[model samples]
Target: MKKYPFVYLACTAAVVGASLGATPASAGHMTHVVHAGQSIQKAVDAAESGDTVLITPGTYRESVTVTTPGLTLRGVGRGVVIEPAAAKAAGTCAAGGNGICVVGTKERKVEDVTLASLTVTGFTRSGVYATATDGLTVRHVTAVKNGVWGIAQEGSVRGVFRGNTARDNGDAGLFLANTISAEQGATDTGGTLVERNRLEGNRIGVTVRRLRNLTVTGNHLTGNCAGVFVVGDENKPRAGQVTVAENRIVRNNKSCPKTARLDALQGSGIVLTGTEDTLITQNVIRDNAGTSPLSGGIVLFKSFVGTASERNRISDNELSGNSPADLVDQETGKANTFEANTCQVSRPAGLC
Candidate 1:
């Protein structure tokens, strides 16, 4: 929530910038190869901007931090693993208890850093944590058994997270936030995309908190305590302008104990709190049943901070077997619409 005074870009330019990551290996970009016994940090520290550090298939007992722009840290195959060292690892990445960290300051954002085809597990905190980055891409990585998020980003813009597997994390499988350190207005992401990922066995599959201008689409989420959560609070530039579409969220009935900030969670498909102008459409949500206040197929609950959910649209979703109701609107928010959704039950009746 610390103030992220991003220079707002034109709409067209923002859309273009959203797709600016994923730079292919060019003719001249250097590639540093690391063998089984070598250190990845040495290779990464030796790399310049726009360089590639290609790691071979091996278990690397270390944490990696990337600060250079346009750098690619890619593993050759799925056998490449990164975990904590025997002793305490060094640097801020290990201090943060993350397997990998892509860090940048607010004054200078890291641009176009990519992480692909690796497995980072058994960390005390997040498997992969990124902050203050632009055009970051994380694809085909497996993050499991972490203490917190599987993959997380904050104060970032134009990120692409696709084709990843995140399971059995202590918290959300995928988490994106405006800022976790302070209270401020939502930050525009310039259309970040979260697509086609497999998320299961976490507290929540995906959590988008106090962020705007992003799309969560075509993901498969199940076996978690909850599916997708779009969270907001009473702040300026309200968290909205998001599209949640074409995802399969089902049977997330794994019970999770209540945290300091939230109630105990179970069987929640998609929940939106204190958000405005968001679209929840075309999702297949089924068999999510529990007695929690937030449990439902698609729910609109009053925010704990007392902000009303306003001007949101829920349409064209297929829902069934959800206990209490498939569609629950527990708030008296204005301008909220529920139309064309195939569901049997609703809280105040007649919203099917």
Candidate 2:
């Protein structure tokens, strides 16, 4: 990964200046109203650090980039739409290409924004890309028909994504990648809380890679190719300590060819690969039946060589109405517990 050198320089300068007893006071708050013939970027450029850009109800054909810290861009109503300026710049003829891009450092918090009643669509990549931000709250946002993920966050810490609706995206509805380089022996990413989000009709509802200390709770994931996929490998050894609890995973079946039988099909309630030391509790995994026979309610595949999934708990889950299988496979690693689960299909008459 290419290190953001200018960002590092800016952060270092800010830290040193802060250490020299020159503590920078919080920038005063301001608000800008976006109007016709005025671009969103121009408004952002004119506003100070801790300002709010109130976008009026209109269709704005622009791609906005938010580099300012502690800023909240709010739309008045659902009519506020931001799309790519032109097709050539984003390499796609879609209506909206990469809706809002946020790049911030560690010092500031991106908070208190109600991104509601707006429709973000037709992005070439992701609808929103938030990088290196903290305390960022994305609530009640609607992302639809994007080429890639609806929402993507990389290296973000302490962010809350709640009540957001993501649908018909090419890849996952919400993609959270925590692959930041360790600085000063501390990981800059992780500690994110994703809850109460509605993700449907995407390739995957949620895909988390190379993350730790993530809490995905109370999210409704349905009608996707895969409900939730947790992937880790030798390269990402520390992708553990994640808590996947209280989420409703259901009906994530995708149609596939008949030749791929006995292979876990596109729809899986929860697919865990090389994931260990995690808590999978109180989730409702059901109705994940697709055309392929490899489909299962919950699957645990060993992706890493010589690595086994151990000490993981799968309890109190209502696993029923799944295709191909209802529970664990033989290849899955051992020492995992399956207790108090209401499985429609099981080995013995009672719970195993």
Candidate 1 error regions (>4 Å): 1-26
Model 1 weakest 10-residue run by lDDT: 7-16
Error (Å) of candidate 1 at residue 56 is 1.0
lDDT of 2 at 261: 14
**lDDT string, candidate 1, 1-352, tens digits:** 5522212111211111233222234455666666676788888887778777777778999999999999888886578999888898789998889999999999999999999989999999999999999999999999999999999999999999999999999999999999989998889999999999999999999999999999999999999999999999999989988999999998999999998889999999999998999999999999998989999999999887989999999999999998778999998899999999999999979999
- Each model's Cα RMSD: 8.5, 9.5
**Which TM-score value belongs to model 1?**
0.92
Candidate 2 per-residue lDDT over residues 1-352, each given as its tens digit: 6421111011111212222221223445545656545677767766565666666667777677777766666665456776666535532223335788776666654543324445677778878777777777777778888888898887778778888889999887998876433411113344788899999999889987767778889999988888887766555454667788999998898643333312434768887666667788888888887644336787666654544565667777878887656665534466766787778774323443
Per-residue lDDT of 121 in model 2: 75
Number of backbone collisions per candidate, in order? 2, 5
Report the CA-based lDDT of candidate 2 relative to the real structure. 0.68
